[model samples]
Target: MKPIGLDKAEHAHVESSNNATVNSEKLDLSKVKVEPLFEKFVDFDTFTKSDFRIVKVKNCEEVPKSKKLLKFILDDGSDKERVILSGIKDNYSAEELVGKTLLAITNLPPRKMMGIESCGMLLSAICEYDGEEKLNLIMLDSNIPAGAKLY
Candidate 1:
């Protein structure tokens, strides 16, 4: 096969390879295909306005009869407290997650998951590749104030 290029000889070779008899009277554009670009973009300014805070995990336990649910008691530096349920059981043990600091979306409307009311959503970095999943729980420095909004 001849090398592919803009030259007339290369175009003739490509046409012959497909068993297409090119007509001199008509220009064949059937072999060309145009693909639409797909992309999704989010505005950062809109995303930055969410109220996210660092909270200390005071307690962690597995929910009854649930394989992937774990309940957490988060202290956000006020008299009020927040309860969150996270699906991190497969990534870390209950004992390992207790007493850790994490980021949570504080202002989200409360939602019930698996019959338990969750007040907030814990934030974590997750990556999946080749049918395997990995989760990296966010950890905060001790100096960071509890309930401090993440900018």
Candidate 2:
């Protein structure tokens, strides 16, 4: 999704205002703005039916030979487990990510990344600054059941 009129000065101002340091080497959200030609609406029911759920991150490890890939083992409150690969290594450490709950798209078809089979996608908000990508994993409060659907 594109954000309109997003510019480097605006990005730096926002980050500094929030007391969030812009990791220029990793994420730079100051060069491009969202172009204005994208659709702005979606079918509510169909969109709601998309399989977004809360899952506990049981394990996390770096994918061999890949600097960006991190493999995660997630529990979705079922006997079957889901394995996902996310490009958040630059943003998070394995120890910090383990035992945390994340929202995931559980029904996506499996895709191979770095020879690893990923069955789902861990969802996070991303921002680009100076052509660098940064991820903000969704945080939750209290204890929510794993596999609880996002409404």
Candidate 3:
């Protein structure tokens, strides 16, 4: 059965975002190494304290004096725009990330980095692939509205 709010025509069954296929062939799993799972699990109440939401990139630019940081102006379904700085410049360019939908933790306390107050944290995946470190930001489907909470 479809979820409570979903319509029958909405089913697309799209492929996973990180399929990482090349020429219609899947990447060899042997060359990829993921980190071990956490030894301790947090209680459900503590997990729910984290407010994960969808955010849309309105504008993105390289931060001055930082080679690995990119500044982002995001639409988090709020009246005011949100600013976030991420250190993913080595893997992604600012121009390529504009207008993309992404997942972020919205209720974190503001933290200072490079003299900027980043209000939240963007979610990402990291692993060792092909003997090198690789990071991919947790992108969401464009259809998901900004500030939609994740369960």
Q: Which candidate is the best by TM-score?
A: 3
Q: lDDT per residue, candidate 3, 37-128, as tens digits?
A: 99999999999999998999999999999978899999999999999999888878799789999999989999888999898988887777
Hey, what RMSD does candidate 2 come out at? Answer: 6.8
The residue pairs in collision within model 3 are: none
Candidate 2 lDDT tens digits, 1-151: 2222222243423444223333232223345334355577777887877798899988899888998789999898788878999887777777877888778888888999988899988877665544554456775542988888887
Badly placed stretches (over 4 Å) of model 2 are 1-38, 129-132
Ranking by lDDT: 3, 2, 1
Which 10 consecutive residues of model 1 have the lowest summed lDDT? 1-10
Clashes of each: 0, 8, 0
lDDT of 1 by residue, 23-135 (tens): 23222344433344458666898788688999998889999989888999889877887899988777777786777778998878889999999988988765442234446
| Candidate number that wins on lDDT, 1 or 2 | 2
State residue 31's C-alpha deviation in candidate 1, in Å: 36
Question: Candidate 1, residue 96: CA error in Å?
Answer: 1.2
Q: What lDDT score is found at residue 33 in candidate 3?
A: 84
